[model samples]
Target: MEHPARTLTARLLASRSLPRTDPQVRRALVDEAFRAELEARLAAVGLQLIDNPYAEHVAVALADDVHEPVFGAGREYAASNIGLTRDQIALLVIIWALIVLPKRERQVNRQKLIDDGQHDMFGQEAPLPHGEEVAGSLSEASLLADFAPVLGHKTYVQGKLLSRLAQLGFIERRGGLIFEGPLLDVLLDYRLLADRIIHGTLGEVLAQAGHPLPDSDGADEGL
Candidate 1:
């Protein structure tokens, strides 16, 4: 008979080498013996190996010692609050740029004129004030351009993504323009959560564009 240690090692090696597409391999991957060993090993490092076959990918997280009630529900509620898919988050960031950048530019110009003591350019003693309404509308063309780097090459996919976001109440499309919806208000209410979600969703884009992400300091960087 093979040595007990050698037998366990062989089983682990065989399980790791198995292809996930094969039924037998899938079963072996989640075998009770293998999971027991995995859990024991993970526990040594204060982690847990949860089996979530329904998830598209595995997730790693810090283990919590507290067993408080309603904790799971609270987590679910937070997820629901920021329920936009990854693609939708990316699209929303682009829309925000289109809506905010122009207003920011105008505000800078108005401040400059006021500093120069030339505030009567429009026959008024004060400069025209910038308002939120002016920065909340975006044309379809601009949005398409903003989305080009990520989703532009695939027009069908882009259209579907935009339609999905609209259907989810994240954006409103009217004529050839898009406007912020109630969902955006919810995101803004939780600014930190929104930032973290955007950071994770746009990580690849930021890397490709040679942009740096803000430093993480005990913030949720998405799942």
Candidate 2:
């Protein structure tokens, strides 16, 4: 919501201001005020704020298709762990979609694996990643564990919800595991990559090459 307003504001900024006679300025002001009010309302609860405008400095490892944040690190963000606002929740969704989900996709598929199913680079020690059903508890998925800190939800709850999302057409799942394809698509469609971008140890190298930040969602940093 806030992003939409700001996007609208940016578009509005592109054109000249006509505050002297144009009534459109009022609408923009009203939108900003509404967002502020909404933020205030959310703050009335226990949710704190963190600026993710550019969601800079990748906090988690991700795939190549995911893009980095443009306004991160320097921008002001509003977030809350307890009483989240619609915008705050939306931002979380956007971050995972844009940043986390894409990176997850790149980590698991394609030519990286050998024809016999061994990893080309890792040669089978690629975490041998699998999900152990996650039926009785939420202890199976590490990605859920990784996300719990940022989203401020119980690991169990987050895993359960992700499982549920996977169950529906919203995403895909198998072997008690959830892949990044469908999930990343949803996040991208939702324009979510504006959250944290977890970089790998080779962050400098990737940044110089203008590539997506390296992350540890798959093997530990290296291929």
Candidate 3:
């Protein structure tokens, strides 16, 4: 799973502004030391600390695996948007739908994937092969485009996200495919995979802020 770091959450915590009249509470992001401390505390609670930290947010996999909670508190996410934001979430949901809905996973939900004859974010056709060559300069290629065929998004709204998860370590390249490292190093984990399925850091942030995420659910066909 790929995750992008946001610049704003690094040094200071952004809070909702209020009219003057009271002492302002200093909201500070939990630094590395604090994160380690939280991990230790959670470990005591029988929860294994799966480190999934990002610049603006941090998340861990719960032992039972229902919901993975992100740490950053002040950030806001509106799961819904009129344009690309909604479409991106749809793509993300479709990816997850492939895994969670069991027999229906392969069945693309109509509402989730509205066939408007639009290419995915990468500007490529759908049901992409395990890999593909995007029509653009090498530098113009993004992680989203790389996965379009592998994930099979041919004629749907392209997700607005371009970030790929690589913070854990170095990167590897195999033709048009990008990887964290050698294939042997990969872990079979679905929790992290869901976050990777989600597109757009800002959109996910807004969605987490208790806004509408009407587009989070996507479709394919004959599901």
Per-residue lDDT of model 3, residues 1-223, tens digit only = 4211221122112221111111221121235555455445545444433321111122233344322243223324334322235545444443332322221222233212424434345332343111112111121144244345544464332322322212222123346544332110122233434335345553364345332222334322221
Per-candidate TM equals 0.37, 0.26, 0.22
Q: Give the per-residue lDDT digits (tens) of candidate 1, residues 1-223.
A: 7543234334433432222344433443457775566556545545443322211112222245431232454565343334656666667665544443343344445555665678655433443343452345767765566455566454743577778777765567898888765344333322343355345655445445543344333222112
C-alpha lDDT (0 to 100) for residue 50 of candidate 3: 32
Candidate 2 has its poorest 10 consecutive residues by lDDT at 52-61
In model 3, the runs with Cα more than 4 Å from the true position are 1-84, 97-159, 162-174, 178-223
- Model 2 misplacement above 4 A: 1-140, 149-160, 181-183, 186-212, 215-223
Whole-model lDDT per candidate: 0.47, 0.36, 0.30
Error of 3 at 56 (Å): 22
Better of 1 and 2 by lDDT: 1
Best by lDDT: 1
**Stronger candidate by TM-score (2 vs 3):** 2
Q: 22, model 3: CA deviation in Å?
A: 46
- Of the candidates numbered 2 and 3, which has the greater lDDT value? 2
Kindly report the root-mean-square deviation of model 2 from the true structure over all alpha carbons.
17.7
lDDT of 1 at 8: 36
